[model samples]
Target: MLMTGGEGRMARIHCKITPLSVYLVVLAMYSTLMMLACLENEELNRVAREQKQKTAAPLQDDMAIVRDRRSQHGKWLRTVDDFFKRMGTLETTCSKMVSLGGTYCRRALDNNKVVCLDEDVTLKSTNCTVYSFGIGADTTFDDQMSHYGCDVFMFDPTVNQETIVSTNLKNERFHLLGLDIFRYNRTHMNEYPDGKKENVTGEFDTYDNIRRRLGHESRHVHYLKMDIENTEWRVLPNLVEGGRLEGVRQLAIEIHTMDIITAPAHQVLPLLRQYWQVLERLTRLGFLRAWYRPNLVLETLYYVPGENRTIATCFEVLYLRRGPVY
Candidate 1:
C-alpha cells in the first residue's frame, strides 16, 4: 500500500511539471515575437524620417521660387502705378461742335491755331493745318474748318471717284486723298488684283510717312481728327512712337473697344495691357483728356453677349496738348 501511494504522488508531480514547462515555452516565444515587432517598427519610423529630410530642401526651394515670382510681379505693377501718377490731370472743354453727316462727327478744335485752351472757341479765321482721317462720305467737318480758313487734308480709302471729281463743289480749302492710314505702306496691295483689294489702292501709309510725303515735315498740325474704325489702336501707337504728336495741338480720337472698363488693372489680360500702353504713351506726349462722349453706335466687345446697357464700346475723346488754359 505504501509503494502504490508513492507511485500516485510521482504521477501527479510529473503531470504538473509537463504543463508548467509548456506554458513557460509559449510565454518566451510570445515575448521574442513582441521584441522583433518593436525593432521593426522603430526601423520603419527612422526610414520615414530620413525620406522626409531628403525631400525638405527641394520643397522649400520650390516654395521660395513661387514667392519670388509673386514679389516681382507686384513690384512691376507698382512701377506702372508710379509712372501713371505723372500723367496729365483732367481739363474741361466748351460746347459740342456741329456734326457733319454723322451724329458722332463733332469735337472741340480749340480757340487758337497753334496752342489750344479748354475754354477757347473754334477759330473763326486761321490758316491752320487740319489732318482728318477716315472721311466716310461726309466732309462737313472739313468744310466747316475750311470756312475758318484752315487747310484740311481729308483721307479715306472708300471715297468715290465722282466725289473727288466734285471737290470743287466741296470745300475749296480741303484736299481729299484716297489713302488709308496704316502701320506700313500698302505695297502689299499689288499682290492682290485691283478689283479684289478692299482699299482702292490698298496703299495704306503711316502717319509719319504721310507727313514726309505731303511736305509737312516742318509744319505743325493744328488739329488732328481720327475715326478710322478699330484701326485707331494700331495707328495711334505708331504716331506716338514716330513723334507725330509733338506737333499736334489738339487731337480728337475715337478709341474703340473700351468696354473692358470693368476689368481690374492687375488682371493678366490683353485689354489691360493695351490700355496701360495707350495711357502711358499719351501721357508721355503731354496729352490731356479734355472731353469724352460715349459712342452708342458700336457694340460692346468685352461685356456679356447682347446685354445692351451701353458699355462704352466706342467713345470719342478730345485731347488738348497740356499747356496754359488760354
Candidate 2:
C-alpha cells in the first residue's frame, strides 16, 4: 500500500511539471515571433524611407538652390512645378472632347485680336493663315475667318485622288496654295490611300519656300494652324530649327495618330508626349504664354507592307500666343 501511494505522488509531480514545460515552450515561441515581426517592420520602414527620400530629393535640392540665390519668389518655383505636374495629368483629356463643355474655358483668348472657340464677333478684323492638307468648303475658316477682318491663307499641297482643286478656293484675301514649311524645298507629298484618280499637285514645300512665296516680304504670321496628318513629327523640327517659326502670334493645330503610327522621327507615343514637346519648343521661342488641348480626333494610320492601311485619328490643340490683354 505504501508503494502504491508513492507511485501516486510521482504521477502528481509529473503532471505539474508537464504543464510548466508547455508554458515555457509557448512563451519562447511567442518571443521569437515578436522578434521576427519587429525585424519585418524595420525592413519595411527602411524601404519606405528610401522611396520617400528618392521622391523628395529633387524638390529639396531646388529649395537649397533657391536659398542660395534667386530672381523669382520662392512660391513661384513651387507653383510652376505644381502647375506642370498637374498639367501632365492631362495626357488624354482631349481624346474624347465632343464640344465646348459648359464649364469650358475657351475665353482664354479674350482681350486679344485672336479669339478661340465661341469667339466674340464684335472686333472682327485680322489675317488668318491655316496650314492643313486641305480645307474643304464645309470648314468655317473661309467665311468667318475673312469676315473677322483677316486675310486668310490656306496653305497645302492638295493631294487627293480626285477634284482636290474643287476644294481649292480663293478670295480677295482668302487664298489657297499648295505649299508647306520645309528645308531647302526638300519637301514632297505621299500618295493618297484612296486612289490616284483625284490626286492634286505638289502639296509639300520648304519653310523657306513657304515664307518666300506667301510672306509678301513680311516674315510675320498673324495666325497659323497646321494639320498635316502625322508629319508634324518630321516637319516641326525643321520649323523650329529655322528663325522663321517665330512669325506667328496665334496657333492651333491637329496632331494626328501615334498609336498605330510609329513616327520614326518623333518616336512612338500612344499619347501626346512628342506633340507637347514640339509645342514646348515653340513656346520657348516666345510663341505661347499658355496653351490648352481641348479636342481629339478619332483617326489613325496603319501601314502593312504593300497593303497600306490608314485610319482616321488625330488630336487637336489651340494655343494663344503672347500679346497684350487689349
Candidate 3:
C-alpha cells in the first residue's frame, strides 16, 4: 500500500489539472448562453420598429386630408370677402351732405339718415315731392321735409293708424299712408303693433304702380328715403327695370344683410352673391353711391371668414343720380 515519491507527485498533478479543466468548461457555457440572449433581444427590437411604422402610416394620411380641406375652405371664404368690400365702397362724394332728423331717436348719438342735395337743383321749388318709406313712429324726416314746402308722403304698413292719415305740418302736406312698397301689386300679411297678422288688402304695390296711383309718374322725387328692413333687396330690382328711378334725384336707403350673416357656412356665399348682383344692377342704372355709414346702433356684427375682425351687417347708403335722367 505504500507508494514511491515519483508516483505521489504524479497523482498530486492530476488532481490540480482536473479542477482547472472544470472551471474553463463552465466559463464557455456561460458565454454561449449570453450570445443566445443578445440574438433574442435584437429580434424583439426589430418587430417593435416594424409595428410602429405600420401604425403611423394611416395617421399621416388622415392629417394630409384635413389640411387639404382647410385650404379649400379658406379659398372660398376669401372670394366672399372680396364681394363684400365692393358693395361697401363709395363711388362718389357729396359736397353738401346734410343729416336729416337731427335728433337721435334710436339709441345713436348721430342720425344715420343723410340727404345729399345741391341748392340749385334739389328742393328748390314748392312742388318738390318726397316719399319716405318704413316710417316707424319717427316722423322727424317727414316733418322736416314738409317744412321746406315739399309734399311729404310717408308710407308704413306696421303703423297703428287708418289707411291714410294727414298730419298737421306746413298746411297738411305730410300724408301717412298705411301701405307697403312691395315687388308686386298684392296683399301682404304684416304684423301690427298689437301682434295681429292681418292681410293688408290692396295696400301693397310696386313702385311704378304706386307712382301711377299717386299721380307722381311724371313728376320728380326730390328725395326718396327707404328703410324697409330687408325688402329693398326684393323691391329695388323691379324699380330699376320699370324705370321708376329715373325721376329720383337722391335716394337714401338702409341695406340689410341679416339673411346672409345668419345663414349656414355653406350658404353664406350664395346669399352674398345675390346681394352683389343687386348692387351691380343699381350701378348700371346710373345710381352712384355718394356716402355710406354703418349703423352702429343696430349692433349686428358679422364675422367675416379668414379675417380677425367683424363688420356691421346694416349700412345706411346714399345714392345720387349722376345727371338728369328725365
Q: Which candidate is the best by lDDT?
A: 3
Better of 1 and 3 by TM-score: 3
Residues 14-99, model 1: lDDT tens digits: 33468889999999999999999999999999997766443221233433433453345434334322322222223333334444
lDDT string for model 2 (1-326, tens) is 12345546523233345888999999999999999999999999999877654332223443344334223322332321232332323211111112221222254421111234322111225444434334532334543455555556655444332333443345323333543454322334445447633434454666567567665546466566666656776776777775665656455566554554555533333233444455456544544322344232223433433554433344455544432111
lDDT of 3 by residue, 24-137 (tens): 999999999999999999999999766644321223343343345334543433455565565566655555777766466455644436766654335664578888887765
Clashing pairs in 1: none
In model 3, where is the ten-residue run with the lowest total lDDT? 54-63
Worst 10 residues of 1 by lDDT: 110-119
Give the CA lDDT, 0 to 100, for residue 185 in model 3: 41
Give candidate 1 regions above 4 Å deviation.
Answer: 1-124, 165-199, 258-269, 298-302, 305-310, 323-326
Ranking according to TM-score, highest score first: 3, 1, 2
lDDT at residue 201 of model 2 (Cα atoms): 47
Top-scoring candidate (TM-score): 3
Model 2 worst lDDT window (10 residues): 92-101
CA shift of 79, model 2, Å = 23
| Model 2 TM-score on a 0 to 1 scale | 0.46
Candidate 1, position 66, lDDT: 30
